[model samples]
Target: MSTDEDLDRLIEILPKSIQHIIETHQYKQSLVEIVMDLGRRPEARFLTHPEYLSAKLISWQDLDYSTKRLSKFTDDNRAGIERTLHRISCIRNRQGLVIGLTCRVGRAMYGTINGIRDLLESGKSFLILGCPGVGKTTMVREIARVLANEMEKRVVIIDTSNEIAGDSDVPHFGIGRARRMQVSRTDLQHKVMIEAVENHMPEVIIIDEIGTELESSAAKTIAERGVQLIGTAHGNSLGSLVKNPVLSDLVGGVQHVIISDEEARRRGTQKSILERKGPPVFYSALELNDRFCWIVHEHVDRSVDMLLQGLEPRFQIRRFDPESRLSISLQKVDSSSTSSKGKAMKSNKNWRKNSRTPF
Candidate 1:
């Protein structure tokens, strides 16, 4: 189904008053979410800004009206519309009552991964990093479709919150031929990740939100077993992942080693220095600054090593326009440049399109 039709289903579950406002809004197609809080005016959030849907404050009846029409909220205080990508997360009070709702609109954006099509064909694992709502899940969804349907690879998705495959017993068509294993509980996601590999014998494993240490360890185990992985974790960039103790394992992990005085002198570094513990689970990592802009670290181990050494690592900046035109350029980071937050990216536009392999 089209995104518009899927959006209509989400609107239908809203209270009548807010629904009318959204149905008549000019920019309804770009709606991001609808925020409904108890005793406050309901709001409709778009891509750019948010607008109040009604002046009337929300009441218990209004909240109940919407909740009753949707699926039961999970242990994570989240729920979704059946067979659609839309997600609804609730905010609870101290008494365990749902006081607010964040109705996030999820769309199946095709061609979202066109910029990185070549990397997908390489069959190497990828770890995508970005802030919330930067289209991480959406990118992985399209990746699953392309790999499973087009590349004919055995793909399995670890859908923890049903955000990737939608909240349904049967997986959504957005994922194409890829199979999905729904996680019964959020904490059990790591267990399910292992289960997907052991039971399904998939060639590619796509996971969303590898947040915990156990999940990170599970990802390492899967990668060591030779299965390709495509997953997302919470962080803005690879640097953040390296600094995050819990998720550092995803990028080979970081540890402090006490080297001998002679070795430290030869290396021109402190006696106690940080170094990569082992090989990275992922072969590449992409930082999604925006839906159209991404910083690609093609070699995860090398990039992590450079960061640990306090040196700037070279990377590629890929940008895609609305026309689906991809432009690739090399970005050289200067270690001495502190004005741009200790790093500066010099774009070299001499990159050729035909030089790279096609997916």
Candidate 2:
């Protein structure tokens, strides 16, 4: 059976909340226990659902982080406090269903592995931009392994910090047959990319922390050569993502954008209390700027859009309009292109022509 199948079988034996934690996190039991204790909060049905359990863990971490920063906690208490907070964050990530535990950079997530597969099949590439600790290296390594071993695709991994391959010289990680090119601290990524393409002839190239102007340009150039590029960046969300000059250009050309649910939850908390309680809702594809990022499945797109739109303030229902919320039926969009802006109004017109958006 597949690794996913094995994970699913294990999930079947776990409690619903734990299953959610495990699936979101893909962790073993020992790790799950650490997360549960560090991040537990009281709510009647909160832990009943796995997704909510993960969210609760996130919320608790956020609360702890805020409290520690705002209050007069001692310098002596600082290390312990940070350790506690980090522990929670780590668990939250370990339990993350789509992306695994790591640091937060940009809006990137340890996306559902299947999502990466879809992007690869579409004749497009992916860049998983995030900060140092966001698990981009780990996630990308796993992705490379999955593509190479399972999907039978040739992959090259550019290990800048030795994080993806690890310190032992041999890849201590699970990524399969990934051609490793270690970038010395003084080396340039542009030069590394050139060498990988010229020598390895890989179907896809994976890199960690594409931070320079030259690295960004190289990624685009590699893509132009029909070599799929999957890498990471550091940012919080789609909005913050575009502001990053290096990542912005690479992401703009993406056909699909998969960010961590953790980032989504962070954005959700700002909206309303309800948003913080469940699965993260992706924004309308139209509002997104990435040209290659396509919502290929119309039904999934409609579902995500309807859910996200409801969570926004504009669609919120006040007491006066108990009936004010209109029910939105699922409708399919043929494209995920921003150039289709004029078509957006027309498409919405067609949507309204058929049904209303559910609030």
Candidate 3:
């Protein structure tokens, strides 16, 4: 089904007044989410800006009407429509009464992973880093479908919030044939991750929102067992992950080491320096700058080592043109350059131009 049809299902759950405005609004296609508060007028957030949906103040009656129609919110104050990706998060007052709702629209986008199709085929565990709402979940959903359906690999998803598949016993078709394991509580997600590998015997494991330290350690355990991992974490770049004490294990934990004076002088560096503790949980890492642009670090160990030394590392930038063609260019950051921007040095040796759209 098209995204428009999926959005229509989400629209049906809203109050009649807001639903009418959303159905007739000019920017309905680009709608990102709808916000409703107990005392304020309802607002519709779009890709560019937010607009008021109604003039009348929202009442408790309006909140009850929507809550009665949707599934029950979990311990995390989140709920979703069964068989659809749309997510509804609620805010409670001091008395534990629901006072607000944020209805976020979720669309199943195809052809978003064409730029990294080769990486999926390499069978190497990789981690994806990006800020919130940069389409990290959507990207991983498409990857699960492609790896399960096209590559014929056994893929299992560790769906913590039911965002990847949907809020239901049966998962949404966006995940293709990949099996999903739902976690009952947010704190128990790490245990479920380990359970999936111990019983399922899958070739690849897909995880979303890898935040806790226990989860990071579980990821390393899975990698050590020879299972290909496709996971996403919240960070702007590889440098940020290296500095994060909790998530640093995903790229290989960093530690301080002391070297002899003669060795430090030979390398022309300080006697004390930071170095990676051991092999990284993931072999490669990709930064999702946006939906269309991505920065790829083919080697996590090398990139972390370079960053620890205060030197710029080499990476690749992949982009999709308006025609849906994938183009890749290699860039190297010069450590000696005084300017803040890295010097651009393009490489055409491994450039790929695919004419066919995988979707």
Best by TM-score: 1
Residue 174 shift from truth in candidate 3, angstroms:
0.7
Write model 1 residue lDDT over 9-68, tens digit each, in one string: 999989988888898899998899999999999998888898998999999999999999
lDDT of 3 by residue, 26-130 (tens): 999999999999999999999889989989999999999998888989999999998899899999999999999999999888878988888899999999999
Give the better candidate number (1 or 2) by TM-score: 1
- The Cα local distance difference test for each model comes to 0.87, 0.44, 0.87
Q: What's the residue-level lDDT of 344 in candidate 1? A: 18
Weakest 10 consecutive residues of candidate 1 by summed lDDT: 343-352
Tell me how far the alpha carbon of residue 33 in candidate 2 is from the true structure, in angstroms, after superposition. Answer: 15
Q: Can you tell me which runs of candidate 2 are displaced by over 4 Å? A: 1-112, 129-132, 252-359
Cα RMSDs, all models:
7.3, 16.9, 7.9
Superior by lDDT: candidate 1 or candidate 2: 1
- What are the models' TM-scores? 0.92, 0.43, 0.91
